[model samples]
Target chain A: MATKRKQRMIFVIVLISGFAAATALALFAFQKNLLYFYSPSQLSEAEVTEDQLFRLGGLVVEGSVVRMPDGITTQFSLTDMQGQVQVEYTGLLPDLFREGQGIVAQGKLNASGLFVAQEVLAKHDENYMPPEVAEALKAAGGEHPVSIPKTTVE
Target chain B: MFTFLHKYASPQYFYSWSASWQKWASIIAALLMSVGLYYSLLNSPADYQQGETVRIMYVHVPAAWLSMFGYMVMASAAIVTLIWRIKVAEIMIAQCAVIGASFTALALITGMLWGKPMWGAYWVWDARLTSELVLLFLYFGVIALSGAFDDERAGARAAAILTLVGIVNIPIIHYSVEWWNTLHQGPTVSKFDSPSAHPSMLIPLLVMALAFKAYFFAVLFKRARTELLLRERNTSWVKALLKEAV
Candidate 1:
């Protein structure tokens, strides 16, 4: 019985120590890379550097979109009704791309602190908007466009 | 609640409690899943873009969520078992491993079905995919470690250690999209600012997520109760419990 208890104690100690070590190691490695999601309003207020690859999500600002010299490249501003972010993207866009639509841009900040989007994903329908966009809009005092009607999506 | 939980730390007491919970949870799980699937498949709006592929999201996304969730549950149980020396915690760790691994496998398979048409490839070394694959291996390693030793107690302890070590990969998996230039899309629901999912898509996703959680609780209760019974078979309470069941 004494030997059995000794074994159990040793096992408990090893397992606890192992968890502590792993958690410490993980936190140390990811200290810099875990970027929190931010709105344009928050980004403007906060101390954001030009090199961070952070996420900026909201509706494509109406009438603020412009095509660059290259037809494939487009520049637009995204807004949450409170603040706005200038974004540049050069790629084939999703079919739903349009002004007043929701979009999530993934990329890094440029030397000028402007967002250089690697990808731009647009909402599929007039009624559809990303939840993040809706939340930001709600926070910015805008009402959500779509209500659950009697009809379901089948 | 703390005092209530404290009593069930003993394997013998936990076995009886879990047995009762298993029956209730299983029934609830069946009910919730039936409603969730019926509503999601037949009533939810078809995607204007992806069409039927969006349906795959109902299964794939929730399975992925549960996969990560399962690992978290297992690892947390492992931590509790080791720190508190609670036998019931070990049972929970073991039970969660089986269930979590199954969810991970489902997520991968459903993802493949969705990816073949959407991404134009069945498999790619994207950050999200790779991290998910690594998670599968971690599950396997934990499962394998549990059976390695002749002594069940020693095996459980070793597996608990492995589960703890493997949890380091969870953060890496979650942040892989941000850290690397991956083809996979970033998070849609689990952020602070805005979720990138539309209300039509978002409501179903949330409902499905809840359904999956319920299913997990149902299954884990069953497995944990069985494990407790097995581990404490020699105890007097277990014999009485078995007699009652029979």
Candidate 2:
């Protein structure tokens, strides 16, 4: 019947959206914290209460990454280029954690301007950067801004 | 007898032509794959940053890519078969279904192996991985639906509809890592402006992709020939050809 074509269209849309929503719900459920969070600049400006845990995003500044000899505690300066914040944490860093890469840390800032980070996530080198972080970097006059390569251009 | 308006001039012509093309395709695909494997495994230098594990990118990336590419091809053929009722396009759906499914599964398995060492987890229920898993299931669904009926034509029709409907997953898989907080890495060579990987790495990856394409064509022609033969089994030309061979 002519309704077959309409039926096909409906089927396709329903399937696509169904898969999308299913994952969306699953991600929400699994990541109840869903902690892809705010940058250092945003955190500094916010009127946060004591022990109010939240995310802090920015890049780890060069020459600022130092591992403690104990290997359990470390400190680094996170920069948005325009402003910077010092973060102090006691834990193992992510393997991809290094200087000059984008990251989001979860914790609260002490009055001493130190971020007592509970968790730090480093972005993968698949050339993907969060849009918010990229914008912050751009506003900071950009350091090593990602340039698309010159050849085999597909 | 493949006599749907005689699109091939003659079924005999199609068989002979396809046979020759199939021979050449297999030869080229073999040569290309050997060279590609050589570069991927031995010749290429390890990524200075990611160390030797970066080599996984060669297979994992291309296989993931072809999985999506194969589905797109299948969906297009489905549309062609629906409107023109081309038997070859329907056969293509069958061929593409199996090839695409295998590649999708390969992408997933390799991804898991690569993830455990690098990402610190064997698997995460994130956007990129989950969507790709859905893609593999869709291919399986197509393969099952297409062969479900006692009537072959009816089966192909049902399979074709499902294949077209499943086309939405291709983009989802490609952009999942980029669009979400998934632990998956983003595209390296797929970007048109500039690729993230170095030329040394990109070249071998591209070569391997070409090899995969050539292999797809080689197998495709092989399967299509068998399909053509069976579809034309009742025709006079097929009988003549078989008699001559005997």
Candidate 3:
């Protein structure tokens, strides 16, 4: 009985450890793509090459959007309130895109250090800011912004 | 300790104890669920950003947590059955698979609804969502495998082994948001020194979580009772139980 129990115990350990190893390996291999986009502040801190593609996120500061008269290119200043980056995109933005809204832009930095956006995502209601944008703002300003209150219920 | 555990293995003891506990658990579950739902739907403050849609968190978080918790319960039962040759644990695993699967489905559906407004898309094949879908499949596999064989014990044994192997998915489901750049948001209430959600929202979310837990066990006991009846049909105790009912 003792030997039988020992053998079963060994089998259980091998079974669990083997699965854990597989999960660890898969997560390790896919680590790069699983990462979320960087914020303007994070982009500034990192040593990303000008041509390297990545994600940048934050709020579109009010009145910062400029549409080239040609009507294709739009420029906007993205900020976490403490630090800011200029983003340039040449495409029709999501319908919900507006000033003071949170957004995530994907593309590369140009030689002039301006963000040349490939695609932009924004579909938030007037009152809502993306949680990611709020988090980045908190990190950049070193204080949780009152814009996203912890709760409204008294 | 061994004898104490083995004592409950008699099936009769477990059945009687579970029957008594089931009523109380159901009452607590009902009371808490009603109160939680009231606060969740009517009173809890809307998120500063997500607004009314943030209300989904009340159901979404609890359902998500229960899915993982149910899997753990099933996996632990799988381990107990293998190690000690416990019959009740096998029955418990079968019941847990059903309950866990329900919660996983709820989690997935509610998550998609919540994501649509916040992320500008209903679905993303990201780490968090994919792993949760996989967790659902694992539940399906266990339920199917446990009933696959003509020989009952052999079927149970196979299902138990599968569960032990698939248990690795639980942690992956939990940490997915943190580990990857998924569209899904990160932990708000759980990781911080204090919950990130405010007092009004946080309180109800917690109440809902507890309500789900109590509800899981209440339903678990009922299913386990039925399982014990079917699986032990030939035993003298079950025969007596049926005869007494008749």
- Per-prediction DockQ: 0.08, 0.16, 0.26
TM-score of chain A of each: 0.56, 0.58, 0.65
The weakest ten consecutive residues by lDDT in model 2 chain B span: B1-10
- Where is model 2 more than 4 Å wrong at Cα? A1-58, A61-94, A102-122, A127-154, B1-6, B9-13, B231-235
Candidate 1 per-residue lDDT over residues B26-47, each given as its tens digit: 7777877787788678877666
Of 1 and 3, the candidate ranking higher by TM-score: 3
How far residue B50's Cα lies from its native spot in candidate 1, in Å, is 1.3
Give candidate 3 regions above 4 Å deviation. A36-63, A67-74, A77-102, A106-119, A122-154
Error of 1 at B89 (Å): 1.0
> Which candidate tops DockQ?
3
Estimate candidate 1's alpha-carbon lDDT, on a 0 to 1 scale.
Answer: 0.72
Superior candidate under DockQ, 1 versus 3: 3
Query: Whole-model lDDT for model 3 versus the true structure?
Result: 0.79
TM-score quality measure for candidate 2: 0.72
* Candidate 3 or 2, higher lDDT: 3
Candidate 3 lDDT tens digits, A1-154: 8788788888989999998999789878866556556666666666799799887767788899999998999999987666789999998786557787767788999999899998787623212234555667777875433231011111
